[model samples]
Target: MSRNPSPCLVPVSHANGMDLNAQLVLDQKPIRQQQKLRTLTKYIQSYPSGWKKRFELAKLLYQIGQWQQAIDELSYVVRRQPQVIEARLLLGHLWHLTGKEKNAICLYEQTLAWVQDDATRYHITGLIAQCQRRWQTALDSFESAVLKHPDNSVHWLLLGQIQLRLEKPLAAQRSFDRVLSLKPNDVTALIYSYDALLQLHQVKTAEQRLQQAYKNAPSDFRVLLRLASRRCQQHLVLDDERAATLELIRTVLRLAPQSAEAHHLLACCHVFQGERIAGEAVMQRFVEQYPNHPYGWYFYARLLFQLGQVQKAADTIMHCYQKQECDREIYRACCEILPAAGRLKLLQPMLLEMVAAFPMSWSLWVTVGRVWVEKFNNYELGIAHSTRATELAQDQAAAWFAHGRVLMLAEHYAQAIEALEQGYSLGNAGARLQTIAAGWLEECDRHI
Candidate 1:
């Protein structure tokens, strides 16, 4: 029997514009196998109806990276012998590798209908769910697979991964534990288990797991990077721990010199350690190296802001915004710097554009409303933006409070009282905001 073709043989298009067929021709092969392939091609041409010979030719084509030709031959074999399960599976795999996921899924579903084995059925169902990105469905399928074949560590590992994606950290930890039980010292399982622990906020346990992983695989870049990030996130005040964190990050950089994540983390460490000059230099280099990386620019801008270069910081952040790298952090940073720099008038047009772009962002709307009310004294425009903020974030106490304050300033006492009361009822209004709202309400009542 011919060996099953390795999945790694899938052809990848290269940057140099050389086609897969050209690469195949350039590949060196044993002379005997090349001669045999030529002979087999001619033989298959002579006996076109020979399904067995055609299947053999398909496997050979697959081995030699002739994916399209292999798929053609396999399709022919499956057409002639519809019950050939191996050939059907190979063809489906080839279809998946060629990016014909729908066709591959159809074939897998059809095979599942005929397959009596529960394990195979679950595996196929899991594959279909994965193709659709239905994490819950994949989790169900993988769980079923595990129930039928409890010894399969691969199934357990996949189940753990899906559980993690679904944020079922405890369930993922259980699955990873099962995987580790089956395959002791599996590095991937260890890393995933550590992640699950971290998600559960079991920080100490996660640290212990990381130490074990580091001891087991000292040179593993992923383990080193995770350890460094965890340490940095702890915001360690002790000198020794901070020094160790820096050392770990530097080691990761040495191991993977081109790692963007390592550079980002190292820059963050510098900022955390109060080394602003070093942080600025590292962050500048990082953004230059990875201009498309939003976090790089975001952090660099933060360093600039700290160094009192408010204008340059604002410019860097604006660049990030132009690149469509708008997130909560970026928006919040802009809200802080623009107002402090007394550039609210200069930022008004951009804020309006951002509000349009991120209509759901209550913060953006509130910022625009505040600018209109405080900077320009445009009461009508301020009320309009503040009302929109309240509409977008009905549950946000800050939104309601802001709207109510604007209304009171506009001297719409009744509406202001109602808005302030609504803000008070939202239950998260800070003490200062609640007191101000109460004082305003008293003032409104006096007006009434």
Candidate 2:
């Protein structure tokens, strides 16, 4: 009759030494979460959510870009619950969207360290590497990420970009292939593939691919710029094409006025259009705009040389050389426009003096050979000079071209063809030079 001794569902003690439920002691998280959820639900149900709502408060403040308040609430939540990856992720993204890249990167790295998922970690690592100019590292990171998130086309596109920077076209092609497979309408991958194919000299295939890419990515500036670069590489002197190139450059300038390479390329394109004055103006603007840029003085002097401003060009280039001018490219460019005429004899001698002072200068040797051999048409001396130049500048097409011209003039047609063909492969081949070399080759073939 003792009421069957009521079942003991509680612990032996409580706040008042009374029985308490044992379940609460073991499962505290559910109780806290339930309380929080109930409070949140009550505030949400009542429209404005009042002071009981922390998450909605943070969200609302964030929507209005009241970042300080949102940051305070978010920071509080993170402090209260350090395991909330989503909150950290959103804050990191917000920091980046607000242009606080350094802070964003710090937070992202922290979030990535906490994130257990391999795919997400890979993505964050890739982004961080890319932002730091660690391109090879980025490539490796993206490759692993793509393996984890095979369906992520964005990762594939980014991987292709890293490959392109590293100049691994075959690897790049595979990355782009995956991007296209996942998202057939992706413009970036298609355009990049078109450019990579063109570099391989698969002209027909590149043309078809570019046309299709352009159709899909009609308004893409990169596609247009790349196609324009192809036109330049073709080196046509078409008036209409030149105009189009100029227009494309104008459009690019409008979009990105500070792009140094864009300005330089457009200025070079002007030479083909017979707009030398306009070209000079654009190049001058480039110099003014990018005085610290390496190519500015180089292209400026080149334009000046083409316009017959020999002394000024030499003097301008000399100034640049005085300021850490160990750039082989700058030396080569200077040689192209140093004006090796009777009036400029002293300049050539001065350059020869430079060559004497720096015997390792393949460019100076190439210049020496051009003056002694090709331009003066002194066959034995030219051959000797050219042979010396070739010894120093083995892979230079200009040296080969000058040497081949000397050979052709000396009736060494077979040797001339061989040298000229080598020059063509190395990019000293122009329409005028090609016509001459082809004529010499034909003559040699006839004798054979």
Candidate 3:
């Protein structure tokens, strides 16, 4: 027994009657993790068949965000012991996290064959379908899982989410109700039930659910934001209600000091109270704090626009675009601000990128077409984009009008007249649009 010491144990001589447990308790997480990894590596090398040690190492890697390394170790463990359901499940989860959702689905499906427990089998089946975005399949699998294990609140939550995605709000409401019954005051269930109730037009019930969520999770920023938004939307006759709503939003800002959403909400509250200057100051502070947040700049730009500082608003939009932090809203704002500030040609590239990202958005296509035809005099490019817009939204008067305008620019008089007529007949086209279409149609007829 005295011949060799175990590699896994701390040396007893160095212990010196001291408490190793107390020493471990004082050590930092990284130090403790290093010690564990060394011990596990030694054990794994000493025993080649030690799949348990490999699994432990994989979990440690996962905890430290070494996802690819964790996947490697998990791959080994699963290969060595294919029946290890937990390892297989974790491996699938890692694959999903790494954006290899198809791989996760395949692995989970294979593991389903080995899962003997009805609940686990159904759960894994549900996970496979979820990874594929096959909501119906996931719904069926989670429904069976809930039937097999009715007490699992998590399973019920998943079922409810699937039903929501599938647009079966009534079924989602029932599933979320089960989750609430199992764990009363469940914030997720409360929030989701509120959504379901809203979809079902049960306004009173949804209000009650939102109140319950706020009551249960007053400190939660999401609940506070929701409550504050509802209060802001209502016509506040009472000073007390308006003050309370403003205070709720302030609390959110205090909790999440750098949250762009909280800052935006605070600025909007000020604007709602007819305090545009104060709202501008709040948005300025937000952009200063979160210079990289695209929405922060967007909110600031919008405030500047409302204050009649069109040039400054256009500048802010340019800054956001230069940072390569763009989304649909940012692009749309660019299209508006640049044109209003007499920088219409500056929007050409942004419009192209926006259309690529949102190809099905007829408004974006129309914007692209307008820029190309009006600013760059590229009628061919304009016609191509406007044609795609009309194809994507045949019923949209705006889309048809845009197509007709592009055709008129390209000197396709007959096609331009036909498109303008179609748009004028749509009736719901705005007065400005109909007037412009009529003028353009007359111009095209004169040319022909």
Candidate 1 C-alpha error for residue 445, in Å: 28
All candidates' lDDT scores? 0.74, 0.62, 0.76
TM-scores, each model vs. reference: 0.50, 0.50, 0.51
Task: Encode model 3's per-residue lDDT on 171-221: one tens digit a residue.
Answer: 789999999999988877898898877655566788899999877766666
**Residue 304 C-alpha lDDT in model 2:** 78
In model 1, the runs with Cα more than 4 Å from the true position are 1-116, 236-243, 292-448
Candidate 2 lDDT tens digits, 10-87: 222222222212111111233454465566556756854233266555654554445566666666666666667767
Candidate 2 residues lying further than 4 Å off, grouped into runs, are 1-105, 290-448
Ranked candidates, highest TM-score first? 3, 2, 1
- Candidate closer to the true structure by lDDT (higher is better), 1 or 3: 3
Total backbone collisions, model 3: 0
Extract clashing residue pairs from model 1: none
